[model samples]
Target chain A: MARRNQHSKEELRAMAIEALADLVEREGVDNFSVRQIAGKLGYTPGMLYHLFVNLDDLILHLNAQTLDALNARIDQAAGHGDPMAVLKAMAFEYLRLAREHTALWQLVFSHRMANQAPVPDWYVDRTRHMFEQVEVQLKDWVPAADQRQRQVMARTLWGSVHGICLLHVENKLNVAGDVAPEAMLESLLDHYLSSCAREGEK
Target chain B: MARRNQHSKEELRAMAIEALADLVEREGVDNFSVRQIAGKLGYTPGMLYHLFVNLDDLILHLNAQTLDALNARIDQAAGHGDPMAVLKAMAFEYLRLAREHTALWQLVFSHRMANQAPVPDWYVDRTRHMFEQVEVQLKDWVPAADQRQRQVMARTLWGSVHGICLLHVENKLNVAGDVAPEAMLESLLDHYLSSCAREGEK
Candidate 1:
């Protein structure tokens, strides 16, 4: 077993989160356990509990890290560009993130705590922040849209994009053909946004 | 314990499936097991294998049953009416089904076999039939639209509706308030279909 005393609290936390993520990636959330993660990190279960309130807290922290990484990717994809182009870029980046991190993405959407525990505010904030990035670009595209309209539009579009990604990631969209998810996202964005275009905007 | 020898083979199969569904409902798919199912039905593991090719096959059959139930609800909702009215009705019924059968709905969208087994064709056919219901209505609403447009439109709208339902089901959409999922569905349908309305039609 590795010595926990050799690492600082911050270092131990980071290592535990990475080990948890790796476990989720290999065995999926369904098969995940705190003991397995503690074992993997060469720490006692007591050491893990000392670091985290519980397994759910640890999972939430891992999810928060995922949201942070996704937020960064979206920020990168939104590098100064025409509003619509940046929007497209962001959606593409979101798809890539979901594809590259299928298990984590699935956990974000599908995993619920043991007893319907409320998701922490910080976790919710991270989710809202990701959409706020989309809403920011949306304002540039449709300056006249109101706050509620922007909110709904942001949720609608993100949810739609998420569904597309979910279908692709879960292997529901195309199995035998090896179709690129980017092509599918391109068509969906074209169809959806064209429909959003005002009468003369097209 | 259920008596395995007392029931006919068909009765045993039905009992096993019912027990499986109950297990999924109580514990979620993450905790599902064929042994639990066999135990519930007082059947040997060997007997379950005889009834099903494996657990995956049994789960597929359960998913198939869910699709059938959903299809029936959609058909009932589609009772001859104005095309838009029927579409709205269908969407509401879908939300109801998902809310009422959250575990089954999650399994339908999220679960996959461990070995990447090909989804049986009949399963694919059931899914297509659900979309075909929407396609049939779209034909009535947009007769001028061609086949490819109908296919894309069907998938896009369904994905959007699903995204909306997913957010609500997963408790991400309206955590702090009692915002009705029906209200969200209505706004999405209005925005999506109004955008679909042809110039003359609108």
Candidate 2:
């Protein structure tokens, strides 16, 4: 009676998000719009409204998935015996994931919300989870550091690697004869770990 | 007499760039267009085309100016007695500029050109000039390091600081009760300098 093929609201929602992800991967977040997504998914704008409260809500959901994929790759790089080695592997994995999903990974950082819009709790939790991965490995390397000190250390180290990947992904860092991203990550870790060693000795 | 109001092509070009800079500063690059610039400057888009080949060319010019402003800030933070001290000052200045001109600074890295379209030579020169400032200060400190080693070292150091500033600019690095950007930069510098000291000792 319902046109011989009826889909539940949840199924439609999943279909929309999947189609949106494909669109974002190909054209980037900046260029894509809700109207385009609706068109791509063969739904009217009014139908999309029935599915998502707003475009921002849709983007938030999309970003959550990107964070999960990053987290899984991060988990693979974990549990290595050496704390330094674990951190290094995590850095490599993070960069590799960024390269693999250039637009999606960039959306994690580049997408801006409206002014005074509180970042949703789910998004914050996802981000904090990623930071926790770094914090846990750092604890082994700097056992004496207090909680506050370790938090600062985790952000500092991850921020550095994030910067390296950002530059590499944006094609801004290859001016000097195409130095591989792996080399850059290794240089950063070598310098950072050597400093930690020196501190331990002191 | 052709016209009472006669401006040379170069003068009109400069005027368009200035108006564009103001437009980007106020409205952001995403919300601006050549038509808007023509509207602001009392000219037609066709007239504007005589000056800049395309919108991309106009953006490249604007980016060059931003890079110069950044290079000037880097220069001010240079020549300080302590290499570590100078590095810290440069980091602070870099963050300050980004905060002062958030959109403009972001455009420096966020603006992506089409594939197969090479970055203009002038833009490359401006970027290389900024890196060279870091290299000169590093050479005085790491006096015995050769050219290739110093190049890698300069990029590594700059990349770390750049990462901190980028995170701070994007509001992604502040999760734990507002750790100062200054504190993060210092932690990175202190650790990096200590590593260099250990390397020198070896």
Candidate 3:
């Protein structure tokens, strides 16, 4: 109770998100409760509501943090290189993040808004930005592709990458056989990118 | 209570599973309770327990049914035709099922076992069978690839397709821009399969 006066609203919000991330990483988002977060911070759920509109609001912020982290990783992987190599590296980085931070990554895709409201504009921009990373490389790799074509290409490629990671993380890929996700990803890049390269040559 | 003796154990099990599937298709698997299924079927949770080991068991049964429906649709699409056309049709059928039966298709991928037990042998077989449908077409399209290569190829191609649909179903794909999922799938297959065709030619 005395701790309520110790921090500003923003500070409490950050602390709550940090605690929430740790809990999600440990126990997963399923059956997760706002009280658990407040309990970890020695605060009350009512106090958390003051900082965030509700649990969904807090989760959305956490997901936005995750998107930012993912974007930073993609940026690191997208450093000056051949466009094809950069795209492949970016995807591998995406897969690595999903593998290493299973719960957090799953939360981004799995958590639907409780009220079924549209996602916020900032969040949509963050997500679209991920595709933009691929679009930038595709521009270099296939100069003839216009903005619309690049948008389609980016979604196709990244969506495929995401699908592989999703199935892998959910433990569904092995049902297809014991092929590693890396192998599948490599094969995809080999066939799909080579085809794109040929398309560029034309 | 009077209805208790009306059906044999097997009949009750079947009826309960049918009712559970309807509920899942209507309401999704999240926060789903066995009590709800029993309530729908005019039985008690104790009776559901007799038919199912637990709620996970019931959900697994429902997922298995979903897989069977998907398999049947693919089979219908896979009828005698050019392997490429058949493959494309099968993929489209998959997309159609996901779009039309959104909740049921989602449950097949989204529901995780509460106990974290390895998925049952039959469920694995059904999931693997979905990939095999692709493998059959790949066999015709790329005859030179060995068993292992085809297995990898199937996972890669289908994984990408799954990724596109996943993002589409979860409403994440449009953030990448409004490229139709069908268009993306077509591009993936055109690029990927053409590359495989060239590989076979080589």
User: Which 10-residue span in candidate 2 chain B carries the lowest summed lDDT?
Assistant: B1-10
How high is each candidate's TM-score? 0.83, 0.91, 0.95
Whichever of 1 and 3 has more DockQ, that candidate is 3
True contacts kept of 3: 0.98
How large is the interface RMSD of candidate 2? 1.5
Pairs of colliding residues, candidate 1: none
**In candidate 1, how many Å is residue A10 off?**
1.8
Better of 1 and 2 by lDDT: 2
TM-score of chain B of each: 0.90, 0.92, 0.93
- Where model 2 places Cα greater than 4 Å from the true spot, the runs are A1-5, A28-31, A114-116, B1-4, B114-116
Q: State the lDDT of candidate 2 residue by residue for B93-192, as single tens digits.
A: 8889888998899888778774447998888988887678877877877777787777777777778788888888878865655567777788888887
How well is each residue in A109-157 modelled by candidate 2, as lDDT tens digits? 8777744478888788888887889989878888777778778878888
lDDT of 3 by residue, B1-202 (tens): 5565778888888888888778877886564577888888887788788788888888888889889999999989889898889888988998999999988888888888877787899989998888998999889989999989999989888899898988888888767448899999999999999998898888
Candidate 2, residue B157: lDDT = 77
Residue lDDT tens for model 1, A1-202: 4563678889889999999999989987567787899899876788888788888888889999998989999999888998778888998988888878888888777667866678888888888787788888878776777766666666777777777777777766542233455655565565445555562253
In model 3, what are the clashing residue pairs, if there are any?
A163-B163
How well does candidate 1 score on lDDT at residue A49? 86
Off by over 4 Å in 3: A2-5, B2-5, B28-32
The fraction of reference interface contacts (C-alpha pairs within 8 A across chains A and B) present in each candidate is 0.24, 0.55, 0.98
